[model samples]
Target: MKLKRTIIISIFFVLMLCGSVLASPSSNNAKRINSTYISATTEETNIRYINDKFEVAPDKQWTIKFNKEVNPLAINTENVQVLDSKGQAVNITLGLSSDGKHVSINPPASKYISGETYSLIIKKSLSNKLNETLPKEVRMKFTIMKDNSNDTGNNVNPVLYEARQGLDKIYNLVKTDKERALVSALRDGVNTKINNPSATIDVNPLKDQYGNLSSDEKSDFKNAILSNFSIGALFEIKSIFE
Candidate 1:
């Protein structure tokens, strides 16, 4: 009777081990499936990354895809946003696919400015049709590159041409870390002014940085901007920095 009891105990332990072995692969497969459903992708043909930031065209648009259908109500700008380097939100238009598994992020009417960095923010508040939100927020940083192709057949403004020339000189002269940072902050409005003759950008963002510069640095700033920017551009810059 003791020998029979030992045999029964060994059989029970063996059964338990066999059950776990059989269930392991199924558990792993479920996690893999879940990851795909929660992920997203962009539709760019040749996506490129530099210094952990995406290098995109000035007018680039993003098409995000998911394995699960998204809730239509979660498709507004509040859930999906684009913000400039200063953390100011850029107005964007969103288009949802009929199946709701894809959404497109379109740039503003002025599009993005070349030589500026922006962030595309996907909040955790975004939910699917089942009302399940994302596990975390997603933020992507990108820098805009000038799209020469878009300039074709457009008449060049002479004042903009001179302004760009002055900016090129300033770019070559930057040496200190502070100077570089200041130029980077100023590039967005400056680039826009040259790229679009009619564009009137708010230069108020440059105030604090400009105030921190040394006297010589401030003189260079005035010479580069005041001497070259168009009359309208000069007015905005002067009002903000002077």
Candidate 2:
């Protein structure tokens, strides 16, 4: 009976030791989490102020160039949130690159407050995916000076811009997805003219009166849209300057 009791006690001790060893690694290798990390990967990631240019025309729409090339996927952004210093939300979300190798933060004019330095916060972002916690923040400062164009406006009529940008690219063959989407979207305007007797469309943007874009061009435009920010899906409607 004593030998049997000793054997049981030995097993219990072994089980306890195994449990302790299992818990130790988890406590050691747990993810690191903290606030106060800066969002910028490089020290050069500074916000250049175009206030002087826009000051003349406050009412008109404008664009500010970050010149900061951000790789969204490399950041491993689990969820991205942009905020002002007061902690108000800026209307922009995180968008991933087609290859998932990069990331970009998209913000419209509505979210930006003139003369304010906004803070961008990112959480659950790591150098790799499946990471637990790697967060960061960056403060961007800029002020909206008044716009001074004769009709300086942020609201872009993309149809006009499309004509200007597409001027050089001849309608060879709608060989790309980028070309196709552009053709498809412009076709919406085209069909309008077809059904309505009075409706007239300037067919210049639609690739010489024919609405067609190849799969290859469509792929190019997909990248272009990210960098160009074709939110309205109209190239001409996008603002050139702030």
Candidate 3:
């Protein structure tokens, strides 16, 4: 009887130990984000990252993506902040992608300053759909390259320079004379507006040029334009043709 009682007690302790092990959370089983990327547009093809920094166009929207789907409710301006070198938060609007794995941050209508360093802060509060927090908080630093035309002085508008560069790229990409002419007209119109803000804008010559391009080409064109121009310049151009 003594041996039987000792055996029963051992069995009870073993069961209890098993229960505890099952109830405890397993660190090895925790889910984590697989990867991340940043882009100037919503298209995945345009996404880019360099050494933990995103080289973004001044006037474009910034899209941040995680390989794992995130909890939409947890994504907000409070959890993601864009700070300048001085650590002041820049005015921005946050938007989530349809898949709930990406967020788009739009700066104030003015766009980011060229040749300036900015930090994108993703706070610890952000979590995946499973309610698991990121392995750690993420802070990414990036710099907007100075506009090519700004070589002479700081007075040149970097956004405008970017717009011109975009137009130049488009011109080089087109093979047909009609497309080239349309791009040239658009480029000329933009240049006129930049050189003389009061000049009467005319985008009518190229109004229909974009209607026939493939979706990929359209995205590429948009990226070029946004990369080269500032929000203000875009607004001025829009006021003419939009």
Candidate 4:
């Protein structure tokens, strides 16, 4: 009977451990952001403000914090976007923080025009690591303050920027820790090869890494990052692989 009781207790402890590991998503993972983090003074349902105002710097980079860890793979142009008044998609950069709870939306290298209004949109498709999506879409409109002197814009090479963004995408979207580490190591090597005339990187490892990715992931990588590269950039990247 003592042995039977011991066996039952062990089973109970094992179940408890499993329950904790596979627990349901947090209730706080709901679609809304805490006003304390963003300072949304207005009572608007979807519209929010920063510092009780709708005016922002021309080179503003908005940081959004969430209650749950977001899925890096889900961060993309389709999920988060900035639109000009003409309904055109602006060239914005989206970066997921190391903790995965924050996303930084960076404006174009040329910066937003002073006195122009732009809308920041976070769609419902934006999801957390558990695949729980935002309950609704989020939109915020802010105008660039009319002050040309404060503009700190830089002339970033578009091709270089796109290539770096591609590397980031691959790093984020990879599933395994081994793949992520490989990408992390390759990033600086690839950047050095691109910027320094005397530097070179072994593309065989990258080619092997790409070959190891699942077909779906490879397709996503090509569509999301590679398809946007310019012909010259594509050739350069292809040459590296060869």
Candidate 5:
């Protein structure tokens, strides 16, 4: 009777061990995304930004790398989507690498709109070779480069060009040397503030210079500058006087 009871206890432990092994997650189930990027150029790998605000060429190709080998069947257009700023879907073709560990996305021709933002979405239904799905859907945002050419004239962002022209007009309107000097000082202060890493910037110097102008002139000047350049770039011009 003692020997039989001992044998039964051993059998029970063996069954428990087997059950634990079966319940453990498999290697494929542990797989996850290792990295992602836009292949901007032959030598460049533009790493994916957490904020999803990548600036890329109009014809940029996207790539996603997995920590483990994936099932080629898991990658498809239905699992991946590219959406424009307006939330309209952009057509794309999906391809898996030879090892099935990487997926590449080829967006439709002319699908990327210049100066616009886009989102690359990976659905949660995407699974690995073991049929283990991702924990959550992934969404990444990117912006097509406003100007992506080597030609000097064409390479300039249109809004930047317009902003520079507005600055030129402002410079011309400053009739006195003192007023021109104040504008120059303001430009320098703004540029300095932009280059600084600190978030809270003191624009008192620029504000003082701006106070010298008439209220109506100030309003018109502000409108011209803001309309031409995004508020973000208006502070970083190399030469506002030019």
Candidate 6:
């Protein structure tokens, strides 16, 4: 089973390399349509150290077979850094793919300490000579696998609560982490105005595995931070699953 798991994971990485290119039309649309990948197996669950789909860790690998061929470019991993909760950075590098499709990220073995969640970020993106500027950076949220306890319904998860709260601050036009990060990433400089660009936003039902929504069920999640959340919320309450 272990060998089989390793083989499957090896195959998964190759496909990801091909798909990681950011310059492709599909990838560009991912910013709009969004993709959420769910990894349910024991092997995959162990890799990301998270139960949810779409988020992953550098140490883990998986296999995905696609019908079409994708031309993916090489990415420079020197600029990729893992940011801790306090926002300190640890460096990671790109692991060469054996197949044209597979890609891997190798962080220092020492950094995989027990019991802490860390966010992954790519400071610089890779672009090849073919005008195929792709192999884009990872997403914004922190990915941690170490020592943090799962949130209990009894005791609120302050970090998630704060993260949600930060979004609220942005929605209310107050200074918030979402506003800060979005403007900081998109802005030219301090006090400079940034324009809102139209893109397809992923409007998905943020339901649990059982597909149930509590009383406050009006809003749809767009996988967006403060600057983008407005696109996801619906004026009318949508699906109600039992």
Kindly list the per-residue Cα lDDT of model 1 for residues 1-242, writing each as its tens digit.
Answer: 66754443333223212221000001101111111112333212332111113235566777778779999999999999999979999999998989899888988999898556688888878899999987667665666654455666655444333333444455445544455445554444445544554555454445556567898876665454433444454333333222
Give a tens-digit lDDT track for model 6, residues 58-123: 353223222232234444444445565577765655543445444445556664443233555443
In order of appearance, the predictions have TM-scores of 0.42, 0.27, 0.41, 0.42, 0.44, 0.32
Q: Decide which is better by TM-score, 5 or 6.
A: 5
Report the backbone clash tally of model 3. Answer: 3
Error of 6 at 55 (Å): 10
Question: TM-score of predicted model 2?
Answer: 0.27
Q: How accurate is candidate 2 locally (lDDT)?
A: 0.33
> What's the TM for model 4?
0.42
Give Cα distance to truth, residue 101, candidate 4, Å.
0.4
lDDT of each: 0.54, 0.33, 0.52, 0.54, 0.49, 0.29
Q: What is candidate 2's lDDT per residue for 75-148, written digit by digit as tens? A: 42244555554777766745555555445565555645432334444443433344333333333322232122
Question: TM-score winner among the candidates?
Answer: 5
TM-score of 3: 0.41
RMSD of each: 27.0, 28.0, 29.4, 21.6, 28.3, 20.0
Q: How do all the candidates rank in terms of TM-score, highest first?
A: 5, 4, 1, 3, 6, 2
Counting clashing residue pairs in each candidate, in order, gives: 0, 46, 3, 0, 0, 21
Compare candidates 5 and 6 on lDDT and give the better one: 5
* Residue 62's lDDT in candidate 5: 80
Candidate 4 Cα outliers beyond 4 Å, as residue runs: 1-52, 148-242
Clashing pairs in 1: none
What is candidate 5's lDDT per residue for 83-186, written digit by digit as tens?
A: 88678889888988888878898868765775456778777778889888765677666655444333354322233333323443444454443444443443
